[model samples]
Target chain A: MEVIITKDLEKIYNPDTVPVHAVNGISTSFEAGEFTAIVGPSGCGKTTFLNLIGGLEAPTQGDISILGDSISTKKKSEMTDFRLHNIGFVFQAYNLIPVMSAYENVAFIMELLNRPQAEIKDRVMELLDAMGVGDKAHQRPHQLSGGQQQRVAVARALASKPKFILADEPTANLDSHATETLLDLMLKMNEKEGTTIIFSTHDIRVMNKARRLVKMDDGKIVENGKPDTA
Target chain B: MIAKLAWRNVWRNKVRSLVVIIATTLGISGALFIAALISGMMDKWVQNQIETELSDIQIHQEDFVIEEDQKFFFEKEDLERQLTAFANEIKEKAYRIKAEGLAMSAHNTYQVILLGVDPDQEPKVTNISNYIREGAYFKEPGRIKQILISQKLADELKVRMNSKVVINLSDIEGEIVGEAFKVVGIFKTSSGIFDESHVFVKNDEFAKVLKMKPGQYHELAIRTGEEVEVEAFQTELQQGLDADLMAESWIQMSPALKMTEGYMDTFNWILLSVVLTALIFGIINTMLMVVLERTREIGMLRSLGLNDRKVGLMFILETIYLSITGAIVGNILSFFLINYFGNKGIHFESWEEGFEAYGLQAVIYPILELNFYVLVTLLVFFTGLLASYFPVRKAIRLDISTAIRN
Candidate 1:
């Protein structure tokens, strides 16, 4: 089943004066359990497109539906509540709260959802173990390595059991080894847990690992298909 | 979890947090200390006035205070009868013959309030004997009348001990009378104005020249050992005394002192508000910096589905933690300092003349009521909440996407 669908989505920055079209028009859909990568060079609107799907940014003009619910018209508070239950986000900078330990970071979103504490604890620990950072649960972000922090961020994203995860340049700050390990873990989760993942990246390594690729340049998609090598 | 996060966030930058805490502590302690010092000084001033000038209660003919005329003298027998009836409630009593008059010396003449009192009873009622600055206190033995002049008045008249001064005044029948008296003592009091205006003489000697009968007196000053129950005693005396006589506590006798006591609390509140104003700005600045510095983290939290209310609460909790911690420390330190100085006293011997001019003591013991500490604690607590408002508004109003990018 299609988990996310966008129809003629457009985002314009400074539309009234010195207008820069960040995302002109994009129509796409992502099926559940798909590992999809939106690939583009800097300023090509890939991250903007991802943000729109995640409901982090409002579209200048468009319609976006996640699991058959139109999210583009939701109020800010409603959108936040929807995102809390349906959408998860991982950022390029490994945006873990510095003051929270790794375990707390994973449990934070679930806590906001008002999930049972026992269930939240079980899910958090299970996700942390799957990410191979279970032993690092009590360490703060500053005490963890870059790759470990990103793993904790992924665990945090998945803690709420969202429909899909939107990762924006998730491996941008990682070494090649850490990048491969993170990608492997995400692919394993997608296959084993039937979790849908859509990531925006300029990294060729990410594009290579993705099952489907959508390429964009200058605010418009130029190609959408599996890689020639695949 | 929110509270735990807020607690940890406050110490994220130890130096910045400590700076705010120390500033708050100093503000709280400084306000309390200044208030205590002022209260102590006022208490001392009131005490001095009561001991040296106004006794616990005073009785006079109904028109004596308003008229100050020698003709307004009441029958002293009535006062003696009341004193005998309430002897257990009374500490001491003195009958006074008061008249506005002129004191003339070899060199100068000055306007004065002539107070004639029994030397033996005046000391017990008003402690006037303790204020002798030069010579003896009515100890001279002679048929010649002896007088006690304030040192300031003595200086103005260029009169020393044993100098003869003539007091000119009206007799009870309104005839101008003059009597020559020897200045047997010089007294100095905390109030320079009182010192310069009043002269004391033996009531019998002045009464004899004024042709006043033995039972006729201008005023009766009473000392009651029950300091807190002075008003009750005054009420009882007023009920028992003749309709022509009026009994008044020291507070009623001196409206200005009573007014000063009433204004003391308002003065302390204004002072504390000024300190809290400075503290409010300091706390707002610190909390604003904390919010600004955590912009990206806040944005990330919002994107993770933490609503604006939770984020705002986090910052508010952090500010409250800092403020309450500072208030506790400040109050503890102030309590210790107040106690330390209260026992040892804060001496202003260098400003003795200045203090004495206003009837205040040279050494003051700081005193604060328990309620004052509670008020300060509440002030700091509410101040912290007020100071957090702007910064928390800024935090919750942030654009999640833009903040995250920044």
Candidate 2:
């Protein structure tokens, strides 16, 4: 089943001084369990496309329907609630809340959803174990290695059991070793839990991990196909 | 959840958090401590002038004080049976008489607090009998010539008991009259300011010396069973008395104490305003700066489904925690400070020499209490809440697109 779809999705950049087209018209769809990548360099509107699909911003002239519900019609706060209920996110900076331990960072969203303490504890532990960092759960971000921190971030993203996850260059802050560990852990979570994953990255390593890749430059998609120098 | 997130965030930026907390604590402590001091001082002043000396009720002629009109006074005819029934006095019991008059002797003359009594019924409604320190009140008609004056007054006059002195009285006709009397006793009280100025005499002797008919008095100082009944009693007396009659309670009679209460109120408001202004600026500078530095992170939270209200609440709770913690810590610190000063007392060397005519001592050492803590805590909470409002609004109103792109 198609879990994410966009129709003529668009976003304008520098709409003030000189209007720049960041994401021109595009329509696309992703199946429920596919690991997809939107690959591009800086300023190519790949992030904008991810944002519109995730319900973070409204598209100028298009629609993004996640799980068949149009995101454009949701109120700002309702959109946030929808995002929280159905979407998990990983960012380029590996944004682990600095002062929280990995366990607390993982359990944060459940807490916001006002889960029982016991349930949050159990879920945090389960996600950490699945990510192979069960022992590092109590350590804060600064105390961990870059790869360890990114693994914790992935564990946190999966904490709420969202239907899909968006990664905006999740490997951008990592070394070669950390990047491999993070990508492997995410793919493992996807395969085991059927959590669809979409990421935007320029790295060949990350692109190779995706089942499919879409290429874009200067606000337009230039190519779309399997990563078949595969 | 927001609290936990915000709390952790504050600690992440520990220096900035500390700056906000310190400024807030200083504001809370300064405003609170000053309020405690003002509140304490007003209480002390009221007790000293009200409950301690003035016995809550006084009776005087309606137009007598203003007209300086001696004729509108309480006289034998004015002492109706019902009035005397209310007097319900026992000489030397729990009540006494307070007569205002000019006392004159050949040596000198001054205002006096002449009290009249059956030295026997004096204590029934007043405290005068307990305040005396010298020769017993004269009993025999032969020694009716006897009088008690303050030692301070004695020193100025160079006279003592058995020393003959000329007494002068002004009558209802504004005519001056003179008589001779011998001092037979002395009076004193712990509150020295009153001691230095007053002389005591029997009611009949006072009336005779003043050339007035018997049974007249300037005012009656009566002690009732309870203090709360004071207002009711005042009303009852006003309704009961003949025309030109008025009754006053200690609170109404002491203008100075009322002024002190008013001053304390104004002082607390001014202090709180200054403190609140400083705290608002501090929180704004720190929180908004956090937003600027984390433009990307805010975008991150937004993308993660953190909504406007949640984002706003996170920042607001951060400020409230900072403010509340500061209030607690500051209150604890100022608790010790106020108690220390409460004991040592702030001295009023400046007021002492200058305020003598007002009969007030210069030193003002006041006590602190649990009520003061509650009052100050409420004050800090409101101020802190007000200070965080605009910052929270800005965060909640943030446009995710603009914030994320920047």
Candidate 3:
């Protein structure tokens, strides 16, 4: 099943002054069980594309239908509503709330969604156990290692039972061992749970793990194909 | 949840929050003080207006007050008969007989307020009994028909208590009938106008000297329970009395005195408004700084799926929390100062120069009363809320994306 699609996707960084086209004329679809990666250099619209697909930002000139709802025509408040219900994002900096411990950071999204206390506790414990940081649930972000913090971010992103996860450089702060561990977790979730994954990254390990790779150069897509070096 | 979050948020920047709290506390303190002061002044003016000036009723010639052009001299026997009947039914009365008399003393001769009273009934309806200083109240009522002269009048007369003086009563033929009087008492009424001019004599003595019929009367000193009840009593008395007699309550007797009180009340309100407005601005400044400092944190909360209203609720809750905290602290501190100074006032040495220079006998002990705490609290609570209102709006209206970037 098609979990996400964009028609004539275009995003402008600033539409008013010297409009900088950040995403231009892209058409795409992601399947339910795919692990996709969008790769590019700086200012090449990778973040812009991820923001659009996650419903965090609107397209300057295009359409996005996520599991069949027209996202672009949704009101701003409604677009945010869609994000809250169906999408979860991980930023480059891990973005684990400083005030919350690892367990609380992971449970934050579920709390925002007003999940039942029993369900939230169960889900948060399950996510933390899966992320291999169950023993460190009480540790704050600065107190934890970079890998542990990023794992908490991943746990938070997946806590709300979203249809897909949008992670921006989730492995950027980790070493090789930590990066491989986080990647393996994401790969296992995608394969076993059929949770679609869309990430923007420059990491080769992240790129190699992807089922599909969408590469962009200067706001326009240069490649959209299977990541077999073809 | 919002309240919990906002409370936690306040501690995020302790120094900044403390700054806001202190500034707001100062504002509350200032506002409370001024509101209390104004309300106290109002009570003082209202007290003086009613308790000191006019009595319950003033009995005069049927048409005397209206027709001052004709001296329709009071008939003592007939007026006394009516007064006795009035006294029988309503005991809150002092028959005050008044006449315009020119007095010549050692240093100064001026027109004076000569009041004649039943020495027995003087203490019944008014505070005149307490105003007597050097001599005792007329014990025999009719036997010791001596004058209780005012301190200022005594000073002008160059006479001490129990000194002999002569008062002249004029007849229809313009001949002066002088009578010797022993100054048996001195009245030092605190109010300046009364202290300088008023003199009291036994009613019978005044009648004997003027040879007014044994029962003539001019005015009535009447008492009621409270100042607010004066007008009610006056209106009731007016309805019962004959149209020939003219009656006025204190409010009408000295329109200027009442006006003085009314103007003071207005001034008090104006001063409180100015002080509280300044206080509001002070609160807004502190709260705005607090809101501006929390922009990034607020953005993070918004991104966590907290809606605009939840964010607004957090800020407003914090503001109310801040206001309530500050008001309590400030009220405690200010209430101490109010009590300390309310009872033992700060003397105005500066104003003494102006008062004495103008021959204005200074009021050395100006009483500062703080009986209206509820009024002060309510005024401060509302002002505190108003002070926080706009800052709350600004906090709520933050653009999350822009805020996050900053």
lDDT of each: 0.89, 0.74, 0.70
In candidate 3, what are the lDDT values of residues A1-230, reduced to their tens digit? 99888999998766777889888988889998789889988789887788778665668898988998888888666765677777766766676667668888787778778889899889999989998999998988889898888888888878887888888777877899999999899888777667788998888888998889999888888998899962
| B251: Cα error in model 1, Å | 3.9
Error of 2 at A95 (Å): 0.9
Candidate 2's residue-wise lDDT over B174-193, tens digit each?
A: 67766566777765443456
Interface RMSD for each predicted structure? 0.8, 1.6, 2.4
Candidates, ranked, lDDT = 1, 2, 3
Q: What DockQ does model 1 achieve?
A: 0.68
Give the residue spans of candidate 3 off by over 4 A. Answer: A94-155, A171-195, A205-212, A225-230, B56-64, B67-91, B131-133, B137-145, B165-178, B226-228, B286-291, B339-400
User: What lDDT is obtained when candidate 1 is compared to the true structure?
Assistant: 0.89
Kindly report, for each predicted structure in the order presented, the TM-score of its chain A compared with the true chain A: 0.97, 0.96, 0.95
**Predicted structure with the largest DockQ when compared to the true one:** 2
For model 3 chain B, give the 10-residue run with minimal summed lDDT. B358-367
Evaluated at residue A147, the lDDT of candidate 2 is 78
Per-residue CA lDDT of model 1 for A129-225, tens digit only, reads 9999999999999999999999999999899888889999999999999999999999988887788999999899889999999899877788888
- Residues A18-110 of candidate 2: C-alpha lDDT, one tens digit per residue: 898889987888999889889989889888888788877788888888898998898987888998889998877678787789998899888
DockQ of each: 0.68, 0.70, 0.34
Highest-scoring model, lDDT: 1
The ten-residue window of minimal lDDT in model 3 chain A covers A75-84
Cα lDDT tens digits, model 1, B112-222, are 988888888888888678999888779746978999999899999999998999989888888988999998999988788889999998888878877888878988888
Error of 1 at B305 (Å): 1.7
Q: Is the docking of candidate 1 incorrect, acceptable, medium or high quality?
A: medium
Candidate 2 at B223: error in angstroms? 3.3
